[model samples]
Target: MVLYGLKNCDTCRKALKLLPEAQFQDVRADGVPGDVLKSAYEVFGAQLLNTRSTTWRGLSDAERALDPLDLLAAHPTVMKRPLVDHDGQLYLGWNSDVQAALLG
Candidate 1:
């Protein structure tokens, strides 16, 4: 199991706190690898990006025009928080329903 997200993000923090036993790869300190981001994009499509994040809203019009792959490659921070990969399944954000399914 691999969780990809920043350390400071609240939702990410919640996910980590909720599942203390889960393994995580902190993207803020460790930096999200290109291949990992690419796989995330493929798995979640635009859903991978958290539109509600300040990072997403702060992007310039030109930045928003970039494709999914380019967007992730350029600014991984814009990607959704608490993106979890358990085995091969992917979950975007931390929803209770999703949590229930994954934790089981």
Candidate 2:
């Protein structure tokens, strides 16, 4: 399993604590792999973009208007938190549903 998220994200930290076996890939330090990002985007659609994030808020209207993939590539942190990859299936967020799916 691979966890793509920021080290400073509390939700990510909580997920890492519970999923100790998952390899943590800090998205800020090393951006999500292109293939993985694309796959996640395909599955999650606009949900993959964290429009509420500080990065998103800081973006100019023009920048925000860019394709979500472009925004994510330029600002990795703008992607939603704790995007977990398990056996090639993508799971977004560390919510109860995800916890049950991953940890059960």
Candidate 3:
């Protein structure tokens, strides 16, 4: 499995602690693959974007008007933390429900 997130993000750190065996990919450094980003958008839709993030807040209205994929490609931190890909299934976020689904 692979976890896509910013290494410094607190939520990503917590998720990493839970899934030590999973490979960690820092989206800012490694960049999210186009295919994976496409798949994530398909599965999670707009939920895949973290609108509440400062990164999102900093985006100009013109940038916000861009397509979700374009926005993510331009600003990886705007993605919701801990997008887990396990056995080809995509899971977004790291809440109790996600923990139960992935860790249980």
Candidate 4:
């Protein structure tokens, strides 16, 4: 399993605590792979972008108008946290549903 998120994020830390065997990737440092990003976007649609993030808030209206993938590529922090890839399945965020799926 590979989890992509910010190293400093609290939610990411929590997920990491439970999934010690999972490989963690700090999105701020190493960007998500193109294929993973594309697949995530397809599965999650616009939900892949964290509109409530500080990074999203900091962007200008013009910048916000860019494609969701472009925005994510330009600002990794704006993407949702703890994007987990287990086998070939993609799970976004550390919500209960995701926990159930991964913790199984």
lDDT of model 3 at residue 10?
Answer: 94
- TM values, all candidates: 0.84, 0.98, 0.97, 0.98
- RMSD of every prediction: 1.7, 0.5, 0.6, 0.6
lDDT for 73 (candidate 4): 88
Write model 2 residue lDDT over 1-104, tens digit each, in one string: 99999998999999999999999999999999999999999999999999899888999999999988888999999999989999999999988899999999
Residue 2 Cα positional deviation in candidate 1, in Å, after optimal superposition:
1.3
Backbone clashes in model 1, listed as residue pairs: none
Worst 10 residues of 2 by lDDT: 64-73
User: lDDT (0-100) at residue 34 of candidate 1?
Assistant: 76
Report the C-alpha lDDT of model 4 over 46-65, residue by residue, as the tens digit: 88999899999999999999
Better of 1 and 4 by TM-score: 4
Model 3 Cα shift for residue 28 (angstroms): 0.9
Q: What is the lDDT of residue 84 in candidate 3?
A: 93
Candidate 3 lDDT, 1-95, residue by residue in tens: 99999989999999999999999999999988999999999999999999999999999999999999999999999999989999999999998
Pull out the clashing pairs in model 3.
none
Residue 9 Cα positional deviation in candidate 1, in Å, after optimal superposition: 1.5
Quote model 3's TM-score: 0.97
**In model 2, how large is the Cα lDDT of residue 6?**
91
